[model samples]
Target: MTRPSNDSLNAAWDLIDHSQLILVVMHTNPDGDALGSGIALTLGLRQQGKEAHLVCPQPTPLIYEFLNPGDIVEPEAPAGVPDLAVVVDCDRADRVGALQGLVNQARRVLVVDHHPPTSDFGDVRLSHDGYAATAEVVHYLLAHRSVPVTGRMAEALMTGLITDTGGFRFSNTRPETLEMAASLARAGASVADISRRVYDSRTLAGLKLLARALASLQSSPAGTVAWARLSADDFAETGAAPEDTEGFVNVVHSLRGADVAALLREEQPGVVRISLRSRGAAVVSQAAEALGGGGHALAAACVLEASLDDAEERLLQELRKWTAF
Candidate 1:
């Protein structure tokens, strides 16, 4: 909400304006907001006659393929080292995976994010948790500069807004959020099309994985903390990847009397990835931060180096400490 400061925010714009070559990146395993904002920014920059490329640690997830061009995002940076790099929807450079080296090599870096702060890395950090998603920040900046919101940019930014706000159903959806959405809709972003593609287009493998995740659901004695687990075997058997597990934790959060929900997936024998979501006064990010992850107050994530059993107990303890319920 404090913005990257007025001066810092302007400096970010100045930096982008002056730079000729730019690289845009998001966190590893990016969600809709990260991907959407990244695409919109890259396209906007290119429209202004600057050279911009988007480099992600992983390939685009299947569900989001519709919003991306075939060659828009790549796993590797271009041969030429960019003069400026803009980190979108992410606060830490390390979260961009092996590409952090390339980011460091850039003459300057600007971080545009909507998460609570974790570490400071970029020269200009536009960290605003007040906005519902990073895409909103991009849209506002574009508007401030009087940049035309093309249909492509509108659709991409709309994807960011709708997905991160859980289709405008989450607590983060402010009046401004709805206004931005309405504006994008006016600019030719189709709400019905985006909803169907993002929320209702899961693959058959993903559906099987969701079923397994539901079957593994468990809860605390008071049912205030609900959780589910998935082994590597579950993914293999279901032919689903980590991306398929997206939003599964939210399903656990829907449990009656649950203030906090978690989904723990064993990526391998000893490592487990966890997602946490909360309702009411629970600040799940505090627990996630303690677990070496970071996100918003209502939603967060972390990874565990311990066995699945130990990881579950550790996450439960942290969630219990943070949740009033």
Candidate 2:
């Protein structure tokens, strides 16, 4: 990943300066980074008297309900075409899901993300490669534009920072990332509160789902690779929503001597979603891309319209290419 070019950065602000009504959107799953960056940017734009609205096709995950990403992320797209639409977190516009229709009608589109830019989606891209999270890039852009950071904005940005960095425990967490987090804390984001809700909080349904996932865990012959599966039945039986499966992959990754891990869930009757994690020689993003998905090097995801066994096999095959031992 590379940093945003000065030309693209200038074009992004120029597009904003020339527009009035702006539509903000994130990827379909609406993770902490998506919700936080979208909310913070929406709030900041509104503070400057722009008619900015952040909307998503999917509801905010239960774990991120504290940020109230749903408060402004209505399902209804704006009736008319927006002067500019900003896509956050995701590199491609298609990842916006049902909201793609709304983005298609916008006069201009700007992307704010940290993913490896694989597609030409936005008219002006502020995608940076080195940041720990998209929220970090958003913060840098906001400061570059001289926007005043509000308490609410700070809170949302912190959510993105903490969650994506795993509370600053991941390899991507740098000194500068911590400094930005401190700045956000000074603006009002509570580290303890965000951590408690995101990492510590658990629902009965989620716990039940975790048990089923653990029961289904499997490993490769070498024991360096691990995976888990949950069918639609498991989710329905446990009364667990899709978002409840969020961190379950980490449990698989924690398996002793595992270099790579995956969690596959049947999102629908034939549609399976897989999340990948790696901490060794594997770069899961390549596997994700081959499976028609994309993400960071350590974390990536993909979707497959196949049976649980088939999807599991596909992912295992991908992992086998990297984790031979």
Candidate 3:
């Protein structure tokens, strides 16, 4: 979809105004960008005299505990249907989990996301691969409509911007992204606090989980493609949650000669989840799409029909083709 314009911004605002209760949902196993953008948008909508609440499938990362002061509700919902629902950072309705029913049952829907989507599930869609984060798109949208940004809102937006852009290390980070970060910082976002909370608060289980992933790492074809497979038993042994496995693929991508990385996680007995990362001269999303998934050029993911070992081998074969070395 196209980037939302000023006129489109007004249309979104108009939609918000007419809707009585706006239900906001984000992707499952949400990262900082997903949680931050959804929460910030919820806060922004409430400040604008609208009734807004956040619902997600899984609990947010423990690092984000500093953001809010309550339990993440896994609501036994379907309380009628919402007047309007906004999906942020979710590419597909299935990513919304139990709320998928609510999205289907809602009267109107809008999807505002940064990822290249696999599904066109929104009545009004605003998707831009150019933006570094969905927080960036939503920030500009709110700023265009003269929506006031509180101190808390600034903090949330900054968290999304920093985390998704790899603290500005990722290739997607642009000059405008930095400028937006500066603006958010100036508007009362604390870089030190966000950094400390997100990066420095690793749990003991997370550390052990990282150790297991590192131990399982493998390289192929002169180390152009690196990979690791994590099983449910590994998580049980390490006492780590699923979110702890996040970014383990990046460890492989960081290898000196490795241009691409894959993490094949056995989420269930027969279900394998594939997460792909690429640095340069490789298009990970293409491989993901070939497996019925989609995301950005640098990072993408897919669910494999095969078992763990088979999925890992299949992904390794695909990654081998992308490597020049």
Candidate 4:
């Protein structure tokens, strides 16, 4: 909960300006927020006369492609790594997958994130839980340095801010959040268009994934937690890509009497991915970090080295102990 000092911001600005090449990385299986923030920062860094590129461990989310500049992310680092590496929207280096070495190889690593961190991975970290999305933090960084916004930057940043904030419906939506969104809109970001692309468009495979998840929904006796699971075989059955289940967990959370909702997915043979959402500040990141994962307080996630069934059992055990308080 420490406020970032002026010295840290100034140091980040200096590093960003002096670096010849800057490489930006986001977490694996990126969502709208991750893509939006990374692309906006890419634009911001380029505008400052620095060469910037985006690298992710996996392919860009289909929903995000429309908002971002076409094919902005390079799945592999081209040629050599950059002089400076920056991670956006993610807290830990492990989440960057193969890109972790790129971060370690960099002379300077600047992390701009909003997620609650279990480790101090950044040489200069500007983290604020008050912000709804990482794009909001990037917006502040641009404003602090008096950087002008282009329509591309505005569109990207606005997509992140609106989607992560649930169209400003979540409780984290504050006056400053709205102010940031208004600024992006004034700079030529279209709210209606962003909504249409992000929410209105969905593939048949995605709907099948949703149906499978909903069929697996189970609730606790106290109605405190509602959970669903999707195994690897289910993905094969539905022909659903990982990105198809982007916000499927939120559907379980929307149920009546549910204070918390969780989704467990089997990414591969042995990797199980879990997403947790709480109606209040239950601090799921602590639990996630304990299981070698990390995220925000209200919405945290972890990947367990176990089957989806085993991971669910372990996660529910932790939740039972936490809710006991």
lDDT of 2 by residue, 179-246 (tens): 99999999998999999999888789989999999999888889888889999999999999888887
Q: Sorted by TM-score, highest first, which candidate order results?
A: 1, 2, 4, 3
Task: Report the lDDT tens digits of candidate 4 across residue range 147-244.
Answer: 89998889999999888987778887878888888989999999999988888777898898899999999998887789999999999999999888
lDDT of 2 at 193: 91
Better of 2 and 4 by lDDT: 2
| Reference-based TM-score of each model | 0.95, 0.94, 0.91, 0.92
Mark the 10 consecutive residues where model 3 has the least summed lDDT: 69-78
User: What would the per-residue lDDT of candidate 3 be over residues 41-145, giving only the tens digit for each residue?
Assistant: 888888788778787756567888877725333344436568889999977778877778788887899888887767788877777778889998889878876
User: How close to the true structure is residue 77 of candidate 4, measured as C-alpha lDDT?
Assistant: 76
**Alpha-carbon lDDT, every model:** 0.87, 0.87, 0.80, 0.83
If ranked by lDDT, best first, what sequence of candidates would result?
1, 2, 4, 3
For candidate 2, report its TM-score.
0.94
Give the winner by TM-score: 1
Worst 10 residues of 2 by lDDT: 1-10
User: What's the CA error at residue 27 for candidate 3, in Å?
Assistant: 1.4
User: Which regions of candidate 1 are displaced past 4 Å?
Assistant: 1-8
TM-score, candidate 4, is: 0.92
State candidate 3's TM-score: 0.91
